[model samples]
Target: MHDHAHGIRQGDNRRLLAVSLAITGVVLVVQVAGAILTGSLALLADAAHMLTDAAALVIALVASAVAARPADDRRTYGYQRAEVLGALVNAVVLIALSVGIVVEAVSRLLAPEPAPVAGGWMLAVAVVGLLANMLAAWLLRHAQKHSMNVRGAYLEVIGDMIGSAAVIVAAIVILLTGWTRVDAIASLLIAVFIVPRAIGLLREVFSVLSESAPAGTAVADIRTHLLRTPGVRDVHDVHVWQLTRGAPVFTAHVVVEQEVLERGSGALLTRMQGCLAEHFDVAHSTFQLEAAGHEEREHH
Candidate 1:
């Protein structure tokens, strides 16, 4: 039953990512042409950002598909970790793109005679790009909450939106005051917006890859909860981690009264599993019920 629901969600994620990728690809082509026609650094920077976003979306799409594969003999947990790896790649690409944009912006600012920028053309193109980004963001907003791969694509679209806005502002200022350096300044601002978000995403990807417990879940709290179960005397060797976003796995050795163990463990197991699912949002759990003093006998 859980597998059925998860498969549906994966299908939804892939559809959303595919639509967003199409939108971004169209915007990338438009922005590239706009930048060439307008000679605006802001537009060019936005185009470059979109280029990377399109690539990121492709990676996310592939990862989502791979993650949907069922577990096999060799790969017990399936390919869910593929999504995390995809997100990690997206973060690195974003950081590198931001650094490149910053370097170019600085060079443009230092130049004595800046390139001519056509304000009207830049404004028209930027507005179009902004509207496209908004559509893509709306599509991914809900899915991003549940999947790291979707979130990576969503963040890149958001950054593109900001870059478009910066380009529009630069165009307006150029039209009003004829200060072309604002175009370079706008590019710098876009780069600044990208780095922090990418770094934060990178941190989350690392946490998942390192097999750390899901955010906001404490192992100690899980141990305490398990110990409270009827017939459960103690809990040890408790382990909690995630296969992917929203997919937590838990395992623990539960010490129960000797009489309870001798009688049966079925009812106790159901109760403990229910407790974990209700309190900790952990649907996949394994508990080994043991007689008291069992831990003392086992070699570590």
Candidate 2:
């Protein structure tokens, strides 16, 4: 496979992760303290989500650093897949925390507790958290489009941002009506928000690990494109998979007419590679040129 040449900023990613992680750590402490003082389940759940954000940022930072290493003889693909693993772990953690938050929120809803809450403290702490998560989310927004590793971190931060908003609203409701169940309701909202995103992230990571073709690609369409090229008789064993997010790799066997093989296969190879790159943006691909029906002999 050739290089797909995706644009990845390892240095910038690390810096963003570091800043986000530190800020999240601070927010976690602040929110946790606020949760205890205010007895706001929304604040508590947001704190828990912030905790996962910190871990995800750490993982993403390490993964980005590892992924930047040059390829070696032993590790031909370099360390790109490390980022995928980090993203996978981040998703799993988010899923776990989301479930726990949902269960706790449901329990609180069932048996409303007359918990004393300092609405002011919850609001103050959550406002700070909202700012931090918003900044972190901004840093990761562009990177998330092209990098699964960064997307994992971004999702965590965005989730916390939503949680912060929930906390703020819960604080307002509690202050106005003295209703404690609103806190549980806010936590449930955060949990509900987290589920679909966490599941989406997991699906992405799973797709990478399972070597599934990138989304929005049609194998049949690709085959048809290849067959339209001159000197190409058929295409078989076509496979496409992502090495990392935004880096798709392809391999295929192209059957050619005997005359084309006798003349030269260089032009056909060039055209095949060009078609894949032009149409599918698949720069990294391997093509095997074979005489028409050559696979029959191999099967025999």
Per-prediction TM-score to the true structure, in the order listed: 0.95, 0.91
Q: Which TM-score value belongs to model 2?
A: 0.91
lDDT of 2: 0.87
Q: Which pairs, if any, clash in model 2?
A: none
Best model number under TM-score: 1
Per-residue lDDT of candidate 2, residues 167-189 (tens digit):
89999988899887888899999
RMSD of 2: 2.1
Computed on alpha carbons, the lDDT of every model, listed in order, comes to: 0.90, 0.87
lDDT of 1 by residue, 242-289 (tens): 877877888888889998978888888888888888898888888887
> Over 4 Å off in model 1, which ranges?
1-8
